[model samples]
Target: MKKIIFIICPFIGLYWLMSSCEDFLEVEAPNHIITSEVVFNNDETAIGALNGIYNQLYTSAFSSGWQDSVTALAGLSSDILEVIRSTNITLKEYDQNEINPNNTRNFNIWSSGYNIIYMTNSLLEGLANSNNVTDETRNRLEGEAKFIRAFTYFNLVNLYDDIPLLTSKDYRSNALAARNSSEEVYELIIRDLENSINLLGESYLDGERTRINNYTSMALLARVYLYRENWGYAESLSEKVIAQSGIYELLENLDEVFLANSKEAIWQISPAGRGTITSHTNEGSIFIINPIFASLSHFKLSTGFVNSFQEEDKRFQDWIRFHSGLSVYYPYKYKIRNSTESITEYSMVLRLAEQYLIRAEARVMQDNLIGAIDDIDKIRSRAGLELLAETNPGISKEALRETIMEERKRELFTEWGHRWMDLKRTGRAAELLGANNSLWQDTDILYPIPEEERMKNPNLTQNAGY
Candidate 1:
C-alpha cells in the first residue's frame, strides 16, 4: 500500500512541455503528472525537480510561515531579539522562553525541513538507478541533492537534538522511524558532506549564487566540525576555503555584503521576482516595516545585542538601522525591503565572514592562538575596527577566545540563530538566556518535538521542558 506523503511535487506534465530555459517557476508542479522514472530519465525533468526544491525553499511554509524563519525563531529564543510589545502569542512565547509544542512556527520549520529532505532523497534514489544524464550532470545533481539534505539535517539536529534521520522516500520506513541519537545524526551529516565534497565540482552551476559548490560543502563541514569540537579538522577545512582568495574575497564595504551577487556569498536564495522591494518570500520582507506596504515588524533587535557592538564598528554604523520615532531598531543588512524596479539582494545562507569565524574558533580550540587571532582580525578590520592584538597587545588566549565569541555575536546577530546556537554549543545558553529571561531553564535549549508529529509517529518524543 502506498502510504500518504505530504511533500509538494515539483514535476508536472506542463513541466515536461515547457522549455528548460524557462527558469524560476513560482509554483510547484502537481506531483501526480510525473514519476521518479520520468524525472530521472529526462535531464530537463530532473532539473525541474531539483529547481522545484529551491522554489519551495523560497516560499515554503517552513521557510517563511507567519513571516517567520528559523532565524527569527532562534533569535527570539536567544538574547538578540524580543517581541515588539505586541499581543502576538507566538512571538511572545519565543521571547519568554515558553515555546508550546503546538507552536505554528516550530511545526512549520520541522515539517518543511523534512519535506525538503524527502524530496531530495527521492531525487537521489532516482538518480542512482538512471542512465539518461551525462556523468558531469549526474555528479553535480547528486552532490547538490546531498548538500541540501545535509544542510536540512544540520538545522534539524541542532534544533531538535535527536530527530528521525530520513535518507529514503519509503513512507513505511520514514514515517515510523525513531529519532536517531545526536551523535548518529552528526555522523550521517558528516558522511553526506563528505560525499558532497567528492561529487561537487569547483565551479558554480550556471553562474548563479543560489547553487552550492564544492567549497560551500566544505564551509558547512567546517561549521559542523566546529560545533562538534573537532578542532583540527575544522580548522583545516576552514583554511582551505579561506585560501580561495581569488574566487572569494571579503568585501571591504559592509553595505555590499548582502547585495545580490556579492562576492562574499557562497550560497543565497533567489527571490521570486526582480525588484528593489522584497517579495513576501524574502526573509527580509518580514523584518522590514513600511507604511506603504505595512509589512510585519514582529521582532526587534534586543538592546543587549544592539549595544554589544563597539561604537566605531562599521556594522553598527551601516548594518543596524533605527526608526527615530518608534525608538526601535531592525537589521539593515538586507537593504531592499520593497522593490523599486530590479532585484538587489538575495537571502544569504552561506558566506565568507562565517568561514573566518569558524576557523577562528577552531584555531582557538587547537591552541593556535596566533592563527585564530589573525582570522578574527580579518573580520574586525573589515568591520572598520582595530585588530584584536592592536587594541589589546599581549592579550592572553583566554581573553582572545572571549573576544572572538563577542565578535561573532556582534557580526552574526539577527542573521541566523548563530547567537542562539553559539551559546548552546559553548554551553552558555543557560547562563545567558536565564539572565535575559527569568523563565529560561536549562532544558529550554532543545525545542519540543511538535505535538502533531508526536501524535502521528509513536517514535517521536517531546523535549524535557515542553
Candidate 2:
C-alpha cells in the first residue's frame, strides 16, 4: 500500500493588530492577521482546519477502505466471520503466524495513523508560539490541538505498541529518536489530554460542534483512560462531559443518530457541498451491505453480539435492518446513500451516547455500581426503555461490564475501528475467531512496527512477538 501523504502547515509569524481610540482611524489590520487570525484564527478557521483533519481520517487508506482490512485483522483476532464461510475460511486464515509486515492491512494503518500524528504535532507547535491570538481563542485552539494530538497518540499506542515518540515536527530518518514502549506512549497521550480539558470549549452541533473542543477532549480522555486501565479518571472525565451536556444528547430515535439529521452528535464531520459518493453509498448514510462487496451476501451477526441486545431496544431499530434473502440482517447505521450529487452527510466521531457508555464502563471499573447502572440506564432510557428497576436491579458487576461492552458494540458498529479493538481487548479473539491464530495470545495485543520503518530507521524496532 502507498503511504498516505499528509499536508502539514507550520505557524509562521505573529500578527499584531494596532488599535487606537477617538475616531478609530489609526488602527490598521496587518495582512499577517489574515493568515493567522482570520483564515487560521476565529471559530470558522478552526472549523475549516479541523475539517481537513476529519478528511484525513475518512480516506480509504485511513478509515473508509479500512473496514474490510479490519475484518481480516479481526479474523486474525476473531472479531468477525469470513464473508465466505463455505469451503473453510478458518483453514486458510492469515494469522500473525503468516503475517507479512508489508501486507496492505498492517502497512496502510501505520501510514494513515502517522499522517494523523504529523498533522496534530504541526498544529500544536503552531498554536504554542502563535501571536496576535486572543488568549480565549488561543486556549480553545490549543485545547483542540491537544485533543487531536492525544487522539493520534492513543490510536498509535493502541495499535502499535512501540512507536517513535515524535512529539515535535521531526520527519528525518537520521534524526535522533528511539521507539517508546506502549506504556510511555500512553503517558504522553494522557498528559496532553489532561491539560486540554481545562482549555477547551463546549461546542454544540447547532453551534460549532464540528471542531474539537473541551467536551471532545474529555471524550477522548475518557476512552484513553479506559484503555490504560485508569478507571477513576475515565469515569470522572466522561461524567463531566455527560453531566454538563446541553446540545449533545442521545437520539430518542436511535436510527436518526447515524443519519444526516442526527441531533445527538457532539462532534461530526458535517458533510456539506459535494464529495465522492462511493458504491458503499454516501450523503449521510453508511452502507454496510452492498453489491461491491457481494461476499457480504452471507453476513451474519456474532451470536454473542446479537444476544447482547435487548428485545425491542431502539438501537436495533436504528442500526439493524433486514430486507429479504441473499443479504439480510444488514446493519443500516448509515442509510443515507444518495445518487446524483451528494450534499450534507455528517461523519460521526464523538456523540453523547458514547459518553454515556464510557461513563458506564469506567464507573463499573471504579466500583461505582449505582453510578454505572445510572449511566447505563441513561442509554437505555434514551432507547425508550425503562431503567433497571428495583426487581431486576441491573446485572452483576461482571455481567454489567460484559453488557456494556455489548451495548457499545451494538451502538458503535461499523463507525471507527471499534469492533476489532473491542474483540482483542475482551479476550474473545480465540473463541469467536476459531483456531489457526497463535499470535492472539497475550503478547500479540498490538501490531508490530512495519518492516519498512524498521529498515529505514535504526532507532525504530518491531513490537514483541513479531
Candidate 3:
C-alpha cells in the first residue's frame, strides 16, 4: 500500500518530456507537495533533502541492470567479440542478449540515468525555494547537486552524445530537445565539476562506510581531468586525494576488492537494500557457467594480460573462474552475482585503486616514469605481486602505458559498464572486438537516441550512422 502511494505520488504516469517544464523529471514530489510548506523549512528537513540525493545511489539506475554491467553477457552474441574470446583474449558469455532491448529500444539504464538527472534537478529546485537554508549550507548542497548532475551528464554524453542539456525543471511532456554537441557537453561537465570542487563539504556521513566528501569530490575531479585529457590537473588532483593521509588502501587480496570492504574506498556506491530487476545475460558466464557456449572452452586469459601478472599475485585467484575442473581468467571483480535468486550486493563506483591508476597514467604522460612506477608498484604490492624497480623497466613507454590500462580493466572489469567504455576510450575496441566495422562507427559508440525522443522534438536529430 505504501509503495503504491510512493510510486503514484511522484507520477501522473506522465513524463511530459517537454521543454518548458520538462528539463527535469523527478519521481518524488518534494515534502511540500501536500502543502506549500518547504521541506527545507528547517535544518532537519534540509538535511533530509540532501540525504535523498545520496539514496539515489542505490537506485536500479546505478545498481544491477544491463546498463549497469550485466551486458557482459553479450560477448558471445556479437560476431566481433567471438574472435577475441576464442583466444585467451576474450571471455564473453552473454552474446545472445547483448544488443537486446525493451520494446522502446532503450535499456533501463537510459531511463535510470535520466531519472537521476531529474531527481537532482528536483533537489536543486527545492533548494532554491527554501528560506531557512544558510548560504553556507545552501552552497554545499548546491555543489553536491551539481557534482551529481555533472557525473550523470558525463555518462549521458559519453554514452549518447548530443544528449539534451537540461539545467532547469520543466519535464512533464514529450517536448523537443535538440541534442547538444559532444564537445559542448564535455565543456559543461568540466565547468560543473570545477565549481563543485570548492562547494562540497569536507565530510558527509551516511551511517558508516560510504558517503561523499571532499576526498570523493577530488577523486571525481581527477577522473574528469583524465577524461578531458588534462594530464597535469589529473596528476595534481590524484596526488591530493592520495595525500589525504591514507583515506583509502588496496584490499590485501585482489579477489577481496569486490567483497564490500571500505578500508580503501575513496567513494563507493553500496548495494544494500536495493531492488531487483531481470538480469540480461553475458558472454563469460554463459560460457563458463551456462551451456550455450560450450563449443569453445570458456574464453581463456589473454597472453598480453596474463604475462602482466606475477605468479605470486593474489588477484589471480580472483580472476580465475573454475568450472568443470577448468580454471580460466574470468572477470572476478563482481562477486554479488553468485546467488541465482537475487541481485543483492553493493556496487562500488569510485575507489583508491583507480586514483592510483590515474596518477600513474598522468605521470607516464608527464615523463615521470619513476613516479608512475611508484604508483603502479603500490597497486602491485596490494595485489601481492613483485613491484617494478623505479630505475629501469625493460618495457618501452608505450608498452608500460598499455600495462597500466590493462591493469585497470583487470581490476575494475564488469563494473559501471567499464569494460566496454574503457575499450572504446582507449581506441582498442576495434582491435579487440570481432570483425565488425560497425563497432568503430561513432553512432555505435553511443546507443541510438530513443526513437520516441526524436519523434517528439522537431529539433532533435539522430546521431550520424544511427
On lDDT, the candidate that comes out on top is 1
Each model's number of backbone clashes?
8, 2, 30
Tens-digit lDDT string for candidate 2 (110-155): 6556656655665566566556456776676677767777776676
**Candidate 3 segments exceeding 4 Å error:** 1-37, 62-105, 172-174, 206-209, 259-261, 273-312, 325-330, 334-345, 390-394, 434-443
Model 3 lDDT, full chain set: 0.57
The alpha-carbon deviation from the true structure for residue 447 of candidate 1, after best TM-score superposition, in angstroms, is 0.6
Shift in Å, residue 338, candidate 2: 4.4
TM-score of each: 0.91, 0.77, 0.76
Query: In order, what lDDT does every prediction score?
Result: 0.77, 0.59, 0.57
lDDT: worst 10-residue window of model 3: 1-10
Candidate 1, clashing residue pairs?
275-343, 276-338, 276-339, 276-340, 277-338, 277-339, 278-337, 278-338
- Cα distance off (Å), candidate 3, residue 160: 1.6
Evaluate candidate 3 by giving its C-alpha RMSD to the native, one decimal: 6.6
